[model samples]
Target: MVNETMVTFQGWIGTDVTDRYVGEAVVASFRVASTPRKYNKLANGWVDGETNWYTVNAWRSLGRNCMEALKKGDAVVVHGRLSTQVYEDEEKRRFQTMVVEATSVGHDLNKGTSFFTKTTVGAGGEADDGALREFNAELGIGGPQISSDGQALGDFVTDEPSKEPAA
Candidate 1:
């Protein structure tokens, strides 16, 4: 990693995040579009420059978090290792694409405010419901309701009846 290129990009999500299992490890892939703007003294206005696109890949827990938290059009900052991928088409034309293997990805707080939720993982790499329950209790909120089959029914206790249709 000493000589490898590392870059930080601030851009808008250009495509939906897609996550899939690669041999038991999850990987999320998405595209980001970055456009540079500059102020022109003569024009007395801001000038938009050409847009550059890059593909980003995040692995493991980061991948899962990205799949849940990111959406198209959201402003985000991505920091990662940069590399180039080359391919040849059927017509014998060669193309190169920039790719970022993301180490950190987060929303641009300057753009808007966001809520933070801490996730607790158990020893087995599963969510720890006890931690969530304790947090909810501390906040004076009810914890999630779990079904007999181990599925979460609701996030908080509600006085109103269920709106979902009975299965």
Candidate 2:
């Protein structure tokens, strides 16, 4: 039998990322706060309610990216598996904590622009592809055209020069 689970949460960063070096690699960890709304029939229709906080850890490149781009109050969507562990504090208090091991993390649309609708344009200016590019060409939203080669956008996080091979 195969045991697999996927969980998603929308939340805001609780604090700044704390990154440290473990040998030659770096690990980044942070806390996120998620709030759920509940309907109250007493004297009001709905009220902002309880908030759930979770610790999130990102490994390697993802950790670096999260550390650089994420900050307090920034909204993000984290997708990954849930993990739990037991710990003993300095006071000898035993506690169990749940954390999420995020395999993929990204910015929330409500907070800022996401990579979902990302696009680029070519000199022909007719839109690289009708299916891919959505915004109007007149808007000048698209950047340089992406080559047909294996130059994936994931390889470049910034506007650096692309090293695309010949098709």
Candidate 3:
């Protein structure tokens, strides 16, 4: 069975992303809203049609980037695998959440300008033999010996927050 569906969209982020550790895995989640806008001949301006919202799930370092880079109302581009999450509330009503397992996300330059840097994970495009490793070395992303407990005498439990990708 072939059930995977790939989707790509450009829109505005509807929420702030916070990255957290979920059992040794870094995860970040946020929402992206897309609406079809067209010129309204009667009003002579752009008119928005119905808005569609999708929950974006970014994993690992890409997830970390989203946490540091994005905020509500920032225009962005996202690409992912489409999936649905079904759940029931205390009232016994079932709801299906539209979700996208985001593989790539970036600022929509059409709306505004932004800065970008290749991540330690990868270059995001086709690989060309050791390029990603070299990029990571330049940025100092993956390094050794930063124990959380030892850093602040067992008070600090998490790594330092990241600040990049201006909103």
Q: Give the clashing pairs for model 3.
A: none
Please name the candidate that would achieve the greatest lDDT relative to the true structure.
Answer: 1
Name the runs in model 2 displaced over 4 angstroms. Answer: 42-44, 114-167
Query: TM per model?
Result: 0.75, 0.63, 0.65
lDDT by residue for model 1 (2-43), tens:
899999989999999998888978899999998889999999
Write model 2 residue lDDT over 127-161, tens digit each, in one string.
24553334223323334433334253333245655
Q: Which stretches of candidate 1 lie over 4 Å from their true place?
A: 129-167
**Relative to the true structure, how large is the alpha-carbon lDDT of every model?**
0.84, 0.71, 0.77
RMSD of 1: 10.0
- C-alpha displacement of 160 in model 1, angstroms? 31
Q: After superposition, how far is residue 35 of candidate 3 from its true place, in Å?
A: 1.0
Candidate 2: 10-residue stretch with minimal lDDT: 133-142
What is the C-alpha lDDT profile of model 3 across 42-115, one tens digit per residue?
A: 99999999998999999877787787788999999999999889999999999998899899999999999998
Q: By lDDT, highest first, what's the ranking?
A: 1, 3, 2
| Candidate 1 vs 3: which has more lDDT | 1
lDDT of 3: 0.77
